[model samples]
Each structure stands twice: as C-alpha cells, then as structure tokens.
Target: MVTEVRGFTDPQKEEYFRKRFRDEEQASRIISHIKKARSLHIMCHIPVFCWITATVLEDVLETREGGQLPQTLTEMYIHFLVVQAKVKKVKYDGGAETDPHWSPESRKMIKSLGKLAFDQLQKGNLIFYESDLTECGIDIRAASVYSGVFTQIFKEERGLYQDKVFCFIHLSVQEFLAALHVHLTFINSGLNLLEEQQTSSQTEEHFYQSAVNKALQSPNGHLDLFLRFLLGFSLQTNQTLLRGLLTQTGSSSLTNQETVQYIKMELSENLSAEKSINLIHCLNELNDRSLVEEIQQHRTSGSLSTGKLSPAQCSALVFILLSSEEDLDEFDFKKYSASEEALLRMLPVVKASNKALLSSCNVSEEGCEKLLSAVSSQSCSLRELDLSTNSLKASAVKLLSAAVESPHAKLNVLRLNICELSEGNCEALSSVLSSQSSSLTELDLSIRKLQDSGVKRLSAGLQRLNCKLNTLRLSGCNLSERSCEALCSVLSSQCSSLRELDLSNSDLQDSGVKLLSAGLKSSQCAVETLSLSGCLITEEGCTSLASALSSNPSHLRELDLSYNHPGDSGMKLLSAGLKEPGWRLDTLRSRMFPEGPGGSSVASLLFAAGPPPVCCDLHRPSPTLLISAVSAPWGLVP
Candidate 1:
C-alpha cells in the first residue's frame, strides 16, 4: 500500500545534486564520482548526510585532480573538517599577518580552544562568557578581528549581563572539539612516555584505560557522545586528515584497538544497556560490522531478559527494538516482570513514545516518581498517558503533579481513574490544572472517592484564566451542593474553556441542580453537553433548568438526567422549556417519569410532531428517553 525510498530516487536525487552544486556539469560529475562508493550513496537518503557528501565531494574534485571520495560517515566528517579549516585559512591569509597553513601557532590556538570546549561541555554549558575565552588563552578581540578558525566554529552573541557570549555554531561541532581534546591529551602522554623510552603499547593501554574510566565516571552521560566522537577520530582515515591539520606523534591503531577492547569488556561485565547503547553507535562509526551483527543477533533472538538487565539496560533494549520496527503502536509492559527495575526501564520508552497504556501494570509510587522525573527533564515526548486501575495513592499523585506543571511537558490526555485519590491529592492536581504551562485538555478523575472538598479544590483550578481543559469526567466522585456552587463559578468565568462536563452517578440533589442552572444561564458559559445522571433531581430542579434554558443564546446542546425520578410535574416544566423559540437543546434523557392525565399534553409539547407515547409496563422498568430532535420528531426509548 505504501512505497518506500531507500535512497533518493531519480528526480529527487538529481534535484538535490543540482541545488547543492550550482554548476550542472560539476554536479553530474560529482554524482558519478560518489556512485562508486555504495555506502556513501546509501547514506545520501538522509538530507543532512547528502549535503555533507556533496560538500566533501565538491572540495575533493576542485582541490585535487583525482582525490578519492569518502565512503564512511567518519571519513566524510573528517574531510569536511579539513575543507572548513582550509576555507578559513584562505580568508585569514588575505587579511591577517598570521600564516594560513597548519602552522605551530594555529595548532596551539586549536589545542587551547579544544580544551575550553571540553571543559565547558563537561559542565553542561553550551554558552560561554568572556572569562572563559581568557582562561583558554584566547584574545577575543584579536580572534574576532582576524576571523580565524576560532571565529569559523565558535560564534559570538550579545549576552544579558555581560557584553559578549560565545558558543559553538552547533552542538556537534562542540562535541567534535571535545573529542579532539581527548585525542590530543592521549598523544601528549604518549610523546612524554617515548622520551622516557617506554614501549608504545604501554602508552596506548594507559590512554585507553584513562579514556574509558573518565567516560564511565560521568553519571549524567555527558561524555558519551564525546567518547563516541573520540573513537571515530581513532580511525586511520580520519586520523590522516587530523595529522595534516594538527601535530601528532604516535600511531592511533593501538589506541583504537585498546579502546574497542575496553568497551567490549565493559559490555561483557553486564553494564546497563541503556547507558551503553552509545558505545554501540561508536562501534558502528568504527565500521565494526561483526560486533554490530552480533548485537543484532542477540536482539532478534530475545536472549536478553528483564532479570538480566538493569533499568538502564531495559531502556536500551526497548530503544533498539523500537528503532528497528516500522511502526511502534504500543509497548506492552505486561510481558515483563512486575519489579521496580522493570517498570523503571519502561519509563524511558514511555517518555519517548507518543501514547502509553499502563492500566493494571502494578506501578507503584517509586515508578511514578521516576516517570515524573523523566517528564520534567524536557526530553520526554509522551502526549497521552493512561494510568487507570493502578494502585497509585495520593502520594504518587503528588509526585506526578510536578510533571504536569512542567513547561516542557507535552501530555494532553491523562486518565487516573480509581487511583485512590483523596482530598489532599485534589490540591496537588489543582495546581497542575491551573498552571499556565499545562497542556492538559482532557482529564479523567472518575470514581476516585473525591468528595465535596476535593471537587471544590478542583473547581478553583478549572476557574483559572490560563486553564485550557475542555472536557472533564468526575463520575461517582461523591459531589454535593457545595461542589456544584464551586463548579458554577468555573462555568460562569469568562476565561473558562469547558465544553463537556460529566458528574454522573454522584450525590448532587435538587439544590445542586438549581445552583448549576445559574451557571447554564450565564452569558460566559460555553458548556454544550452536561450529564447529571442519577443525581436525585426533582420538579424544583427541572423548573430551575427550564428557566435557565429560556435565556437567549443558551449553549446547552445535550442534557442527560437519566435514572432519576423527575415525576410528571418535572416533565411538564421541561416540556414548557422545549417549546421556547430560543431553546437550542436537541437531545435529552430521563427515566421513570410518571404518566398522568397531563402526561399527553407534556409529551405533545416536548415532541410537537411525534406519534403517541408508548405504555410503560408496571413489572418492567421503562427505558430512558434519549431525545434526538434532528432524527425523529419524538424522544427515542431504548
């Protein structure tokens, strides 16, 4: 039913080449040149990779008569780096006193900048102050005037307090520099060892141990991408490019082998899979097809189990599996063990997924806390979450409230039915609903034993000017007249967005119904559908509702008062309202309305062009009337 393009096809590829290379002849020739490398051609499927490929190939064709095209991602990036450096050098030579070639001065400056990038990156700082430049032995004024390699990668911007701030043009560029700093550190250590007459293997082993230890010590995983880039740089083809631009002393092959061996050892030691997945990506960069294939085989065989994995590892396996699938509809956690570790692992997948269904998944307060942390981190992609029928109590609900208030949270639909929420939990939930950053639009708090006080707190949040909620379900929450008063305030507020409200199977009596009628009569009320089924309403409530319905431009469209004893008098009051010229209500439901001498008159007024009323059996309970004005002249009973 659907066509897939493994790589850019025909006109798309041709158009891409034409746009990237302005010269038609050069574009055709470059395309022909890269066609010899199948791996590079396949990578061109991604638009960014295609741009990098075109940039590298164009440089090679222009600068050298018969330069070989880069075949791998690492090789292409390395070539692109060289091209960028050369371009900067050319521009600098025309306007500055310094030599443009890879001289000792330029190499020293590069080393200083790399150190600065690495230090700042480790601290999770992407933007740097002027003091950061001074600490790195960089003269900002001079660098800005000369427009050298520093200016090419690092850009300057005006700051709020300080006059100037600097950051890498892209995070990837900063990552590359951080990795380069590590490689240079290893090279300097090797050079010092050689002066002491130590063997090359010993120096490499030390470097490998040092790099791996440093990477493993970062609990926040800040060094993971840097280590990956460092491994990529260890490749011979990539190192060759670096050698031409920076000073180097020893062979990188030993370092590469040792690094790979250290990673394998770590993986064999049962390290967390989620934390070690980046190592897999590093191996892919090294073109280690055999190891990648082995990992793939393990994944396909389902050899990994929850018992063998840490929460982090479970997260990694789920990510790998989801990436391989074409469509990820749902990740059922029911198949896994009900351990806390298993649930923790599922959190990452839940954060990354669009919709998650965790009904009866045995999640506890600890799991809820973990999921909340993920959501608050601003990295989670979850839009809908269903935690119905869980054992979560008020404490867990409090923990979840922090996530709901997060500005970065994307959740729009949340179901927390029967989660043992109480009055205390309602306070926390109220803060979430009232938050300006909240994205919640549909919420279900059904059958949670939220009594009158709980609904009162929830009503305060619903009345907030910033609340965006449109549909609310509070069935069987033990509400009363006091709760109805608070809800009326929400419905009467000009800023309220409420469209549908369900208070079905509650304890709201005739007084509560009269109070709600005031809200329905308000000019600001936008509610279109209302359900007060089994709420113990009587003729007095129906009279109040009839008065509200007679108001001009009422928004009420569907009303359900089913399973209640509205009586003949109540039916007559409702019938009078139905005959109002301004009344727009189209559907109404009620049960057990007593038939009397005036019943026919009430029925004729309610359904003007309908047939005679059906008789109700005394032994059998009459079905509730569900009036649909557009479809039939009279109410339909089923």
Candidate 2:
C-alpha cells in the first residue's frame, strides 16, 4: 500500500504508459494518484503533462543523490521546483523511463521510483507524519539552505496557483481551485462586489492561525514578509475579522501605543471610515469607561483622547465631534469637560478632512440644542449635519436653515430622519435647499411624517434647487402611491440629479411602484440605486418594474425589493430582468413571509399574494398624487 512510484522518463516508457492509459481510458489516473498522495502539503492540480514532467525531475534528483530526498514531498516538491526553475537540460534514466542526462531505461526506472515514493507517502499521509528529514536519509543542512531558495521561488509564483490546502483544511479536489482563483481574481481586480462569509471569533482565530502557519511555511527565514502578506490577505478576505476583534475584545491586543500605530499602518490603505463605524459599535458594547479614565489621567490627553476611543468609537465620534456646535445646549456639558475640549482644539484637523459620518444620535432635545449652539459659530467648521432621530422640529429647521446661507457653510449633507417634521418644517427646509448658496449633496428625511401636503411643498423646492443633491431617503413618510408619483415626476424631470432613493417601509403598493417605474423610463431621470423594501407590491408591479428596467438597463446598479410581498409570478417577472447581462442590477432578493430565508422564491411568493389596499384599482395609480399626468392612461409610457 505504501509504494514509492518512480515516474517513467524514457520515450518508450512514456509511450507504454500513454498506450496503457489510452487502453484504460484513464487520462487523469496517474495525476489523480499523485494528488491524492498525502506527502504534499500544498496540492496544485497541474495538467497531466506537467505532473509527468515533475515526476521525471523528482526521479532524477532522487537517483543522483540516492536515498537522499527531503522527508515531506512538500519539501522535496519545493526543492524540485527550484531545481526546475534554475537548471536546464535535466537528465535522468532508468531502463523503463529515460532522459538524455541519464540512460533512457535508467530515466524510466527513476521516474517509476519517484511515482512509487509519492504513492507510499500518500498511503500513509506521510507529510503530516514526517518532521525530521535526517531520519529519512536527507541532508538536513543542505535541505535547509535549499528551502530558503525554494521559498523565494514560491513567493515569486504565488499568484499562479496557491496551495490552499495549507490555507484551509476543508480544501478538497472536489472544490475547484480555478473557480476560487477566479473569485479571488475578481475581488483583487475590483470587478465585482464580494462579501465575506460572516464567521464567529473562534472560527476567525482558527483561520488566522492557519494563515500564520501557511505564511511561516511559505519561505525560510522570511516570516516577517509572510506576515505582511497575510495581513494584506486577511484585510482583503474579511477585514471585519480584525475590526470585530478590536471592537468586541476591547483594547487588549492594541493597548500599546506602538501596536496601535502598527495596526493603523497595516490597515491605513483600505480600512475605511465605514469599517471604523462598525468598530465603534463594537467598542460601544465594551465599556469605554476605562478609556474615559485613561484620557482623564493622561497629561497630553487632548492629542491622545482619541486613543481612549477604540478604532470603532473613534470612527463613530467623528460625527459627534465634528458636528458639535460651540453654542449648542444639548451636548452634555460634562462630556465637553476635558475630552471635548481636546477634540475642539483639534477642529482644524477635523475641518480640513473631507470625511463625514451620517447617522442618527439619540440625544435629548436640550442636548441637540446645545450641540447646535456649540456648532453654530462663525468659527464652527461643521461640513455635514445629521440631526436625524433628534427633536429637530420646525423651529430647529428654521434656525439651521439660516446656517445654510452662512458664508462658512461647509455643510454638504443634512439628515433630519424621524425628526417629526410637519409641513412647516418641510417648507422651511425646502426654502434653504432651494437657496442659490446651498451646498448640500445628501438629505435624509425618513420617518418625518412628510404627508402628501408636506411632500408636495418639498417637491416645489426640489424642482427649483440647483444643488447637486444625489441621495434622498423618505422611508415611512406616510407616502401613498400619489406621493410616489410626485417624487417620480420630479425624478423624471430635468431638475433631478438624484442617484439613490429609499422608499422602504413607506406602505406603498404596486401602484406606487408602477408610478416610479414609469418615471424611470423618462430620459432625464438619473436614479441608479433604488430601495423599496417593505413596500407592498404584487405581480403586476413586477411586470411594471421589468418594463422600467428593460427601458434603461445600464443606469441601475442596485435595486432592493426586500420585505415586499412579491409572490412567484412577481419573482418570475423580476428574475427575467435580473438575468439580463446588460442590466446593472447585481443583487436581487425578497422576503414575502418576513420570516423565511429571503430569496427569489420568497419574492415570487410575496407577489403571488393579492395586492394591498393601496392598489385597490390594480390598474389605476393611487389617488395621493397632486400631479394628474401619472394616473391617466393606466400604464407606464413604453
């Protein structure tokens, strides 16, 4: 069972084997046997011809240095590869397999010997078993030197075909390396969006250890280089692993300032602020009170108070710190004690940066007011404002609207989500938006009770505003089909440059979706990403959406109909469009039951269900729209 095979190198021996393989109709038998051999730590399913060539070379090396080969074929394979890359006119011969450098028969015999050796190793899973090459008649000193050179060669060709067996234990020949290679290629090339499979901390640690082992084994005395490579790979594969650890584990691994700097240096190129935000959420879960104390205790705490903040909390605080106005009454005065003062002192650095965080902070009304006052200075350098989920009512909007016209209005984003804005606040905000001096790029008005009337008033300003507003979120604004029509009309007109729209959880039915679909057909419309999650849509709406998508397939990049009741018929309609190669829609899924695994099947089930009350007419647009052009004729313009 533990047979060491020597590959046949003689032309006659090759012919015999080839003829025998042909007779048996086994084109891959020999290569398969070699791969199944357990001596190789890294298995690359090379072409059969390559394997034959490798077998010949491995045989020649063994004969020249009789009974003196590395213990693990992993070590010997690496040694052989180095020899192949460096040497020319390799010669070997056995009576059965021959090469010019050895007798034809001698080369054949050596090749057979090599095959037998590999087979023997495979039978026993010898690579995992063997550690000391000296016991196996290998020159340890020479093998060690050869390993260094071999590692260098391996690194140079790391891109060709990775030895993933060492990287992941689950790798099997059943799994296609080329397919995985293509995936990693796509990711490295940045051609497609790739999401990492979420894994638990223990799993990640296990994988990390494996990665370390692989890197260490990659080359001799190049552990640092291997570590650097692993770091880059880990970031690419699932940077969240590192970020999650930092967040959930607190500041244990990164307590040393040097270590923090090293992590920052390692991740600086690709660690985005968004990743930082996730880190912050994790850190927030960990008690940052110690960090708070640490900040208070430090002499130069101002410059390093941020050190008290984990990478995640620091990322989250970017919003709180930069947007806090000097005159605001809401921000806890106590919070402003030492750390806040230190952050304010660093305002110059913050203001100079282009990054801004858009999130809802659940601070009290007084805290919001205090925050506004603090940031409401001539010297205040707030570039973006997000008062979403705060009590920024009509009065607050009116006051902030003045800041929109201020000479130092560095504001490019404003979020007023769930701020309970009525028509009065809508009008006030719209007036500021319509102003010639407005520098806003994104505005979020979700869950703000923007009924038909308030929406209608805002529509007027939207039509007049010349600013480059790209994203508008009005989810749960009590918008009926008519309100969607109004927004659709604005989006369809020349006045809109909106690239993203989120009407999620808006209670809109098929009629609203249809109205919006028709608007998308208009040549002037530029909306690219659309989210209608939780909207009540039926099969009819899917048909309408398919038509809209067909009208302009290139513009849309992402569309989310998640949580919508689009049953089988609707899913079929959408799937037809999604399968199109020209359409920019990269992801599509739905949740009809709100409990089942969300997928196309669920989407189909949702639409198969009857249309909601808002789509009572099924054919007619909802009556909520003040604009009349959308309802007439009963169908979208083709």
Best candidate (score: TM-score): 1
Candidate 2 Cα outliers beyond 4 Å, as residue runs: 1-379, 594-638
Whole-model Cα lDDT of every candidate shown, in order:
0.69, 0.47
TM-score of 2: 0.40
- Model 2 whole-model lDDT (C-alpha atoms): 0.47
lDDT of 2 by residue, 307-367 (tens): 3434323443443333222223223212322233233333332343343232344444444
Error of 2 at 268 (Å): 39
> What is candidate 1's lDDT per residue for 134-160, written digit by digit as tens?
887777884464233556466777889
The 10 consecutive residues of candidate 2 with the worst lDDT sum are 165-174
